[model samples]
Target: MRYSNYIGIFAGLLMIVAAVFPWISITSIDAVVTGFGSEKVTRFGMPVLMNLFMIGLTTIFFLVPKLWAKRANPFAAAINFSWALRNLLLLSTCRNGECPKTTIWLYVYFAASLILLVMSVLPDMKVIEKGKE
Candidate 1:
């Protein structure tokens, strides 16, 4: 837990970088999809932006040395992880007998989100006992 904050920060950065890479390529439409933009698909409505915002908040919470910030970090991280999962499931699935080709960057994004969640859950903190101190 001593390095959780640093690790979480790194993971957040990694997620941001991963978002710029191609996540999947739809063979049927001959289009490539990335986290920030889906040129041929507009219905997704920039799902990764929410994840980026949550990760940014989580990273800030990790840097803060307040009890309340530590407590709230996990919540943001969990939301980020859930959003990553949703993206993975939706993007990799086959539709109309055509399965999109998944890329390594997609998995990397999910892994970074998961790592951020774990780091947030195990944040290093000092809690004083009401009676002891």
Candidate 2:
């Protein structure tokens, strides 16, 4: 399990770049951000705080070792899942909506985070199925 914490590391670094990159100076204000593929009103306009909050959580996971410990608190997974879900909700804004240049990068980062989160939470099938196999 020596290099076992890579998922959190990857998720964390991506989020850190997302949180502070471009220093907000070069970033676009009118960017579509991201959103799931849905016509519902809930799919529109996410506040900056939500995105920042995720960046913070993910950064914590990356910087804090306790969060990724084998027997650690489950809250980390939940938090990461929340972040991923939030990101997933925003994915379509990149492809389907009128997003700015930065939106694509943000979407990809979050999408990668979503995958990492999924990998973290799902029961490790190999460990669970070994005896059966």
Candidate 3:
């Protein structure tokens, strides 16, 4: 927990890198989907940009040495994690009896988001005793 902020920053960076790789392959359409690019039929929009914004915010919060920053970090991380899950489910789901093959980077993205959430929840901070001073 002492190094939670550093770990969280790493996770955020990993997520950013993972977003560029292929997430799934749809045999029916002979297309590959990534966070930044997806088939029009899926109508998932641009998840990569949104995720980047969220992760960037989370990383900034992690670097801020304040109680409020620590408190807000978890919220940002949770939203990023939820978005990652949404991307995973939407990209890999079967449609009209055709199931897309999930790629390794998809799972890696999800794992990094999950790790970011955990690290945010356990931010390292020093608590001062009221009477000690």
Which ranges in model 1 have alpha carbons more than 4 Å from their true place? 127-133
Clashes of each: 0, 3, 0
Model 3, span 33-98: residue lDDT tens = 788887644566677777899999999999999999999999999999998998888788898998
lDDT of each: 0.91, 0.46, 0.89
Error of 1 at 48 (Å): 0.6
Error of 2 at 23 (Å): 14
lDDT (Cα, tens digit) per residue for candidate 2, span 1-133: 3332466556655654554432111123432333322123333444334545654554455445452443332355556557656554544344434432444455555665665565454322224455684
Residue 13, model 1, lDDT: 95
> Compared with the true structure, what per-residue lDDT tens digits does model 1 show for residues 20-118?
999999878788889997888876657699997898799889999998999999999999999999999988898889898999999999999999999
Task: Output the worst ten-in-a-row residue range by lDDT, candidate 3.
Answer: 38-47
